[model samples]
Target: MFSIASDSAKSVRYVLEHDHADPNESIGPQSALAFALTNEHLTQKLEIVKALLAHGADPASLRNPELNPPHRDSSVGDDSMLLSPPPTTTLEAMDPATRYFISRADAPQTRHLSTLLQKSLFRPLGGVRYDIVGQDQVFEQLFTVLNLHSRTLSVSPLVILLCGPSGHGKSFLARRFGPLLGVPTHTVNVTTLRSTHDLWDSYSMSPYEEITTRTLAQFLLENEGKRCVVVLDEIEKVEEPKVLYSLLMPWELGERVAGTCSPRAGHRHIDVRQVVWLGTSNIGHDFVFEFCETSSGMSVSHGEYLELARLVRPRVSQSLGASLSSRVTTVLPFVPFTEAELMAIATEAFYSLGGERAYFVSLDIVEHVSRKAIECYIPEEGARSLHRAISSLLMDMPEFLEQSNK
Candidate 1:
């Protein structure tokens, strides 16, 4: 009976006490202790958990007996200890498992929220550590922004603009840390977005006019009151002034409408203003050349970028809505990927598949293949070319063939 009840009972206790606990774990009638542990209130649930732990519950036991709370044959009147000292004192004498269970029950809500965030979001973000290195000031600024936004119980959104060249790991950093901070991410491919209409027509309409319409806004609404990190990738692709203006409007004020088109007939608008938006761009070799032609540095000059952004604000307002382009602040640069960084990313990928041997094979073959791909293709290319090059390298590898044969 003890064996049968233990598995379900432990699972029930876990779900009620642990922040990451899945409420769906299986339980049965024979596991009366498990069934009792499902009480919603923390106080009631913890009492049951305490009772089980105090009664010498073995945490390792999994199998449940057909009968639990096994009926005792002897009389209980001889045992007077139960009516004496309280279980509170008895609780102090138990193992860590018991202590941990009790302590978790008493833990504050913030700790529970942290645990839940870690389990659901951070765990899946590849556990990548932030590389502060030369960017201590930058990291401090980012952290300050994140903390400010997190402390907001209402709608105080903080926009973190990561401006650097391509391949600098901007997206990687955002993806990795966004979830852990309880901030949801929705990336916008700036290159793909040519016109105000382009953003609207591409994605489907469900919670909004179109799927892409205010993508960040929709994600924020879904996870209301939570910090949100919106990544606008490759914004340099949006050379048009109108598009740039539209993108910035949302960050300035409280709300910015992306469109006005609904299923009923007319246009539908996507209102998303209270979100932290990060825009990234890589303008090739002509960074200073193009921007200087107008008024700023191709990538680094904030003043020039802002001026250019302001010039195109009207197009977005006219097409989307005057209300849409009213909110935008800050234009950050995307750093280019250095040879060493690219190599590091490749090495990381190899180790992720396995380790040691796998890493060696992938690095050796992938580097050779990637170099050859660039040599065979045009001087300037994009992600598609890179993907093809990698695919070609994997296909040509002798080790890959051997593995497939096995």
Candidate 2:
């Protein structure tokens, strides 16, 4: 409510984006939407409305018929929202965007809001994050696959198999994949799933065998028709290779295949198209390192990356089978980090642990910690070992001790 009165678009965006203030929230006598509607004279009012709508402010709620009646909300006295929006200041008197949610007979069938959000939200290739560190070749190939996927028109889910050495940054990149495109990412560790059809588990209820969804299914259904990223981390760890068959429909046809739990075929398919499916595996770890050694260059060229990616195909096929492997749009080789990158990563990780006390710590502190921490890091284990390295360094620091020695 303060945001609407403050008449600042930035504040509205901050409250919506950071505080997650619900736009339709009813407080006392006024709704957030009602307050914003009354303040039509505010300079940034329209932008505030846009921000609210984008963050899930419902337009239909503003079209309440009883709100305009003379005897409306009378018991609320001076605090009533009816006291604010003057009869002359209706939605028609407001901006076009204000009237957009209330579609009258002559209103266009298609709205710009729908088309605006339909397109994928990724920045161009050059704008990809650099914080991921030492996976330039991987990023290049990753964006190349996304460009081809073009979520705007594609019906099938785009699958990109991320296969390379462990701990380098495959999982790290997977976690950030959704945020990079301004969308939600749902990650499932393949090892944790108990059954083959765990992705969309169903159960017979009320003897009717009605289909009810949970977890990943609910996540997909909630995001139906929208672009999202789903990363199956450590997919090769699944006990049964056949577990992947459950995903074949959504991965290749954009539909969720109902399992035996559902006896009915009518509700079988939950439209999960427009998902960019990521599967991370270490199946091609050895080959990625071997290629780096044979090429013997400062950087792996795009062509070389492509060649290495091709090598990953057979690795995936042998491990996960050819049908699923064939559906993969591309297999990106997550290259092992270079020596400099390893230490650089270690140094970054080192400083992050120090808190404010780190400012007092000297250059040798990082060098000292890095050498010991780096010993635990290996190509196969990747950056996963860095945490242990940091723990070892902390053990020697008096400040980090269980009881500090003052």
Candidate 3:
């Protein structure tokens, strides 16, 4: 019956009625819903799932029997099914199968199916509001690494250094990391400071110091007993290398003490043990671009690009200093956007500016702007120029709107 694809709904109903099959039956530790949700063939067949659900399928069924409570066999004539117990471990600690199911549930197309399931089934997995586009692999790695440390209660700070061309959303990626881990984020532009004291204190009580102190204190207090992501943007631009030492305490030991050179210098301490540090730079942007642009006209494969990144690590490390570079858990490279991604960005920008009228803008116009943007693309400048090109194209929206109304 399962072999028939087009008549899945009718087949499912027939099997359930005649074979007396339990809609929530386990097939190799996976419930029908779990198999249906994860199976690429079945996931898109919403009618099949609807048919199973109509036949009393329990959406709350889990793949791991260990995570579920002992239940009476419904096939033995008693139709009452016991409710599954809540997971004993955090979502990060759960087995891979469960995590995969959760990821599938989080998909936009499956949101309706998720809604039908009991909230308690998935509520243990904390919600993360991350809307950053592209770089799926980067986010996956970030979650795995951070979640591993979180589960182990490791003292070593989770530090990620993002190396990319300017305007490739390095800082934006850092900001998105906080919400994924259910934490707040604080960003500091490392280039603006002149000395180590500028990070935490100043001897003369300068305005910069006052503002920095207030922001630090507020963040520390508000996020007490919880993790926070601290983003140091453009670390390569810092004038004084000594100032970089301020990060070592929090990054390695998870605490920062006020230095003797400060205004509030009575041994003020900040408990930053739960802090995750994100540092961004454009130090080796040109090298990455040059390596990717081949004489044969074909773009570099992902594996080749990564290999090149490894080869250039020494250069980046030298520029940022060994001490800072050594502390970083991983240096993530954000590649330049492809033509398709640029077009998507341009379309998004048009929608942002034009609202409902965005649809009226012809595809030819969007493609033209996208092509011009790509032609003007400079690896060092990144997405900033593309965004500007889209903005410039939208400047004629009034005329387009008038013509559309006619």
| TM-score (all chains, Cα) for each model | 0.40, 0.61, 0.60
Better of 1 and 3 by lDDT: 3
Cα RMSD to native, each candidate? 16.9, 17.3, 15.0
lDDT of 2 by residue, 1-406 (tens): 7787887878986886676678678544555665676654565554566566545555555555333222244556767635434432365444322343323211232122233233434442222233355676776566555554665455667888888887777777776677646676677778776676675542211121124434567668778878887888888888877777777656677777444323346666677777878888988788888888888563677688888888778989999888878888788888877665676667556645644354234445546676778888866787768766776678676454222222
Question: Whole-model Cα lDDT per candidate?
Answer: 0.40, 0.63, 0.56
Candidate 2, residue 10: how far the Cα is off, in Å: 17
lDDT, residue 55, candidate 2: 57
Residue pair clashes in candidate 3: none
Clashes of each: 25, 1, 0
Q: lDDT at 332 for candidate 1?
A: 34
Kindly list the per-residue Cα lDDT of model 3 for residues 86-197, writing each as its tens digit. 3321234322222323443345533443232323221211222123334433444444455567556677767888886787777766655664444666677787778776
lDDT (tens digit, per residue) of candidate 1 on 218-239: 5545644444556666554565
Write down the TM-score for model 2: 0.61
Candidate 2 lDDT at 135 equals 76
Global lDDT of model 3: 0.56
How are the candidates ranked when ordered by lDDT, highest leading? 2, 3, 1
Runs off by more than 4 Å, candidate 3: 1-130, 179-182, 202-213, 221-224, 259-269, 295-302, 362-369, 396-403
